[model samples]
Target chain A: MLNQLLRKLIRSASGRTQWLLAVVGLSIALLLIFAAVQVQVNYNDLLHGKTNQDSVANFLVINKLLNNQTYGNATLSAAEIDDLKKQSFTEDVGILTPSRFKASVQSYSDRFPFYTDISFESVPAQFIDVNSKDWKWDEQSAFIPMIAPNMFLDFYNFQFSFSQNLPQLTQDVVKMIVFKVNINTPNGVVSMNGRVVGFSDRITSLLVPQEFMDWANQRYSINQDTKPSRVVMRTKDPGNPQLVEYLKGHNLVTDADKTRFSKYRQIVNTVVNISWITGAVMLLFALLIFTLFIQLTVSSCKDEIELLVTLGASPKQLQRFLMKQFFPANVFIVLITLLIVTGLQYWVYSILSQQNMFVSAFTSYYTLLTALLILLVLWITNRTTIRKYVVQQQK
Target chain B: MQIRLQNVVPVPLREKILQRKSEVWNTNIVFDQGHWIKIKAPSGTGKTTFIHTLYKIRNDYSGDVWWGNQNSREVTGDALAQIRQQKLSIIFQDLRLFGELTARENIELNRVLQEPFYEGAMIDEMAEQLGVTHILRQRAGLCSYGEQQRIAIIRSLMQPFDWLLMDEPFSHLDQENTRKAAALIADECSKRKAGFILMDLDEDDHFNYFKRVEL
Candidate 1:
């Protein structure tokens, strides 16, 4: 029946009814494609919220124990690291010890949005102690200030003018960036001159590799003593709730610390919800427009319908015929819409690449959910319209 | 009329005249089956309505229209449609030839709609004998008024209908074309033994073939 209808429709192209079906079918298909993509993007953004924080949480969670005033000396020894490895749930572990130091270099004065004052007390700086000698250990150094090279150069360029020829810095700088923990001199004596590396963009406070804390104090020959403000530790089983509980039982964390962790988890849930809802809304809107397009086009041909019936066409035959004409067009329209929409999204992302635009890290479920929703909309709209008018009504 | 229509009802004023009506409020006319039945009435005297009502185009009237042995009201849409296609045909005064199609195609449309009259020879014979062969392929809307009326009559005759209902089939034709159309209809109707119920305001001597009746 459908095939016969299609043949008839092809042979009768000049009729105004055929034209309406073609146009409306194409438009609705395109709208549906756009909506599907929007939903995917919105949902994906939400899923990434939790994982993004998780990336840093593996290390950040340990700090609450070590730094809590109520629970002091919560440091883990090398033996404890070995014990963790033997646990069944353990996968891999990375222990990062970042320290800070102060140093001054000629500022290049051109990369920032605003001019800087080199005349300030210290050149804003940071230093990261990447553990491996592979040089790519710099990967672990990501989350901190010196993630990219030439960043320091860009910073100096924006803030200050370079003076005459300055001392050239060597790559050997990474190896010596950290201080020897046991090294001690007289109370007022210091060892080496401070070597500043990178600075924070959000805050004016300088960032220094944790390995350099002792070295900077001794090198500057100053008596200002300071304890580590934060100590980040990574374990193989960071997500194991039992591990967290075990650590809590060990007096490794105070009640206040547990409350803080719960608060962060709540925040993660909220961010994920926001992302899913945004995607869902975008998908719903697209589907609504798609359905409306079908309705409008179908309704436009109401005037000519009687003429069709007078031609000896059965209602079911007409619908099958319309579907044959419209279904292929709709398929083509959906594909074209997908291509155009995807291309547009790609273009937008490219433009914002420098600013990390459209970057997402999400679970697959959100995207699947959104796609299912769009399909549901199409099924409902097409079924209702086709059944109500095209498949049911007669002269 | 092999069909008999008596006390049939008229359509309502609020409705478009073309739409089929279901309720007849007034009717007081009757016709018996025959080949030369002329329905003569003044303008607005429901002459067209009488013919259309019998043809089952307007069903809303209260009346008894018998199609041979059965009540027309008892016939299904498909059955009535079959009756219109195979047993009856109509000629509008305004001549409803599809404007975009050629006169030949307009005549062919009846063949297309009726029980498959696929023989092209039939169309050729009608056009050639009616002196319209030269204009058969011209767009119907562009044909001369007399030529269009002849084509309309030819189109109605092309169908296999046993009954032909005409509404002033030669209203605007020239004297020569009028005589030609009357002769053509008379010859064809006689050969087919078909019934023709014609509605006209005045009787013309050229249509002496028809047996006239006053409304």
Candidate 2:
């Protein structure tokens, strides 16, 4: 009842259109801030979330630049490999050990006259993308198994076979054919049967099982220096700008197509930063307008307030009354902006999903938390301004 | 509460008042609790100033005014407001009611400003007895001087208080209207065992005065 009479005496701060304009400004500011937070969350989810995980984008074969300074000795030293492992981008690293012996591959079948001086490489089992059971080899096994690169097969089918006037071979047919692997030692030529077991796109080299590679190197290694010149690693995001920057700083190279997101990352960072700064400045101005409005109201009703204080109304009551009038608008702005962002998020999710991009349809918790934090700031502003003006009237 | 004055003198009226003989100026006196007091003064004798000094509205006075043992000047701000709401009530000579509000609203303002001291119907009852019921719904600014005076009297009576300060509260009313208004004031004070210091320019038998002084 007292507040009703007080309300009649002190109407909502005089300028209605200005108040509405300020409210609109506050809403737009809140929307921009919310969009920045949601965009960041979506970008992070795309980079690391399992639903959008790209298997081929997580592993990379890293090697130093083969320039004049490192042409013959491009091998990563133990310290360099350890430093790469210690970097935040590299989740796991496996060195690619090259064959240490003289070797060649020749066809054992009479129908196919295929022979080539081929070198083999071996990597740890964790780094291999194919999971064939025949990938392991021992002296008792029927034939040695090798994992061939899909690029090699594509080249043979599309260009190599047409130029050489030879028949193209599919993966299944190639896997069935056996070949003889010859390793030259001090005594004589050692021969073993070999067959293609699987195909992979992650690595380009002909890969042999680690156990077989170790045995061959132990028995027939002539050039015994086996320092690895290449390494493969698994990471959360191959497109992370930090990873690209690290690679560039260390004079290393990887496939350009996989790290293509660095450009988009930089653009998104600029956009988010611009949105954040603009929103904060606008929010500051909106709050300033509100504070000035509150001051104007209190000053305009200065006589009435003095009479009220003279009539025994405490400053706390007036402060509470002013807060009740102003804070609800802020809360309403925050809620409406949140609803708009939610709608935009769902729309973005549907549009992106049609193109095979996966992102959450709901606003992320971090965005909600940021909204709550902004609301807290608004609440404090409302409380502080009301108290200051009301107490000023008292004085 | 006991009202004590310690060499109380209004600074603006100090020079002229010191040359004259007065009972309240530069004099120490204690008006006991529940005592009806009257301060009579001719025109331009600072009657309103004395009332305002007691109410602590203007503090350009020389000496201390105490409510019980607490000095009036020391009891300030919200504490003073609290005392005005719960311990002291007043009726200014100008009838300082909010002009925008109706006469009834003017009374209701005082009633609701604190934990209400009377039921809402008491307002209508007081308005009826004071002969201002017809103008209760009229704005105080639109009402006649007599009606506004009666409205101010009822408004002052709406709050609980130990002391009621009146400065020519019935000046604009007729003899009959003044009698009715005074009867109502006296009745309300008696009901609460409260007292009042009515400062007027002339003598009148408003109530059985416990003590009377010339200002």
Candidate 3:
């Protein structure tokens, strides 16, 4: 019976049934394709959209300053610091310049008596990092722009240059050390020194100008040999957050500045809403039209059906015949529609990517799963329609 | 493949009977296989309805219709249809031949609908014996009433059905074709080991060889 049904269907497919099926099939196919195109468009837009909030950037680094602190040193030797700064591996490097200064505030009166105590001893005229463009002496006229806007004041000239330390002074005031340096790189990594400089003042612990530290150290007359605790630098591009991470992996930076970043959740949600609604709606409409068509086809053949029944057909057999007629046609249409929809989506994405509107031309798993769901729904709808028709015939 | 109709009741037009009832409104005529039983009745006296009832097409009629002693009350709708397709064939009062089919096609239709009958040679022989072989290719509607009648009878006999219910199949035929149709029907029924319930409204001499019953 199945073979017979198949032969009849093939013959009908080649005959006038083809003409009728073409119109309906094409309508359904176009509707499905339109939905698929919408899905693909929305997906590309969401994926290629502006900075997603769901994404985060992280950088991992080892603390070189902390490693040196295990030896109770607050700073590297001048030669050692120079050697390390000159290494090909360093990036966006800046030195911690320790200094001290005092400022007075009126205690809500015209005659002020109290003053804040501040102190530091040494200051590097300039800090150098081979990776940071600001410290490049080769670009003589265009030195790295100082990110600190308020380093200059009326009483102080905020200027940085290469330091030529007197060997005698370096031995006496070694205790006036800059403890820790902090670098805020674009990658969200915060590198800092592991040890604190042996100083009691709160303001000196932060990244600040050398003039402020020097005034305080001279006023206090602190004289002892000490090391700078840590040095910190910022990346050239704050948006390129990966620079700190890459530097950290090479052991050139400390681990204080590590963070994590990704945009997968945002991308996935965008895809789900965009792809599923369009495809599912198209499939739903296709199913509705298919159901209506099946009903119409069976109703139109009522006379032929009666003739077969009179020729000794049972209700069950008649139901089987109608099922056989529509099953193969449905299978063919759905498979072809799936291919067309998937292919066209890929093609449109490829075309758009060439125009720089999309980052990828590939489809996600959700698209395939959506198609499968649509097919399953169609099958279930067709079966329900068949059962309804069969019940009517029995009545 | 033997069949019997016992205690079939014929009722007024509006009276309905349930499908499973054994005894009909009121009559007894036991029919066996391989016998030509002429059911004679005046107009509107239920001759055709009785034949339909025996063939299991009239569900509202009550009776014990047995196929090889198996009560028809025990069979379901599917089983009854199966019996009609394989064990019973009917020649209607109007001939009910498909006008679109050729004479040969009409005769071959039933054979195709069921399992293959393996009696193609017999069909050709019957057509020739009934003088319809010359016009077998002609559409059945274009044939003479006598030729159409003979083809209907021959078509019904081409299958392996054990019981044949024919209702006024020769109503439009002339005297000469009527005798020929009757002879051909009796000969085919005997050869196939099938019985016939022939309903006629005429005093035809062709029904003389069969057992006669009055309703």
**The candidate that achieves the highest DockQ relative to the unseen native structure:** 2
The TM-score measured for candidate 1 stands at 0.45
lDDT of 2 by residue, A1-395 (tens): 88888887787767988898889889999999999999999999888888888898888999998899888888899998999999998999999988888889988766777778888999999999887888898989988899999999999899988987779998999998888989888999989899899999988899999999999988888877878889998998888889999988998888888899988998999999999999999999999888888888888888888888877777777787788878888899999999999999999999999988888999999989988999899989889988877777776
Docking verdict class for candidate 1: incorrect
Best by lDDT: 2
lDDT of 3 by residue, B13-91 (tens): 4344333332322545466667777767668667777776766556665557777867876765466658777778888
Each model's TM-score for chain A is 0.35, 0.92, 0.39
Tens-place lDDT per residue, model 2, B1-215, is 98999999898899989999999989998888789999999988898899888988889999899999999988876688788998889999988878888898889989998899999999999998997889988988899888898998999999999999999998898889888999999999998899899999888897999999999
Task: Give the lDDT of residue A315 in candidate 1.
Answer: 56
Off by over 4 Å in 2: A67-73, A106-114, A129-145, A150-179, A193-199, A209-227, B5-28, B41-46, B60-79
How does model 2 do on interface RMSD, in angstroms? 1.3
Query: DockQ of candidates 1 onward, in order?
Result: 0.04, 0.57, 0.13
- Tell me the tens digit of each residue's lDDT in model 3 across A54-91: 12111121234336534554354566556545644344
| Residue B46 shift from truth in candidate 1, angstroms | 1.8
Residues forming the 10-long window of minimal summed lDDT in candidate 1 chain A:
A117-126
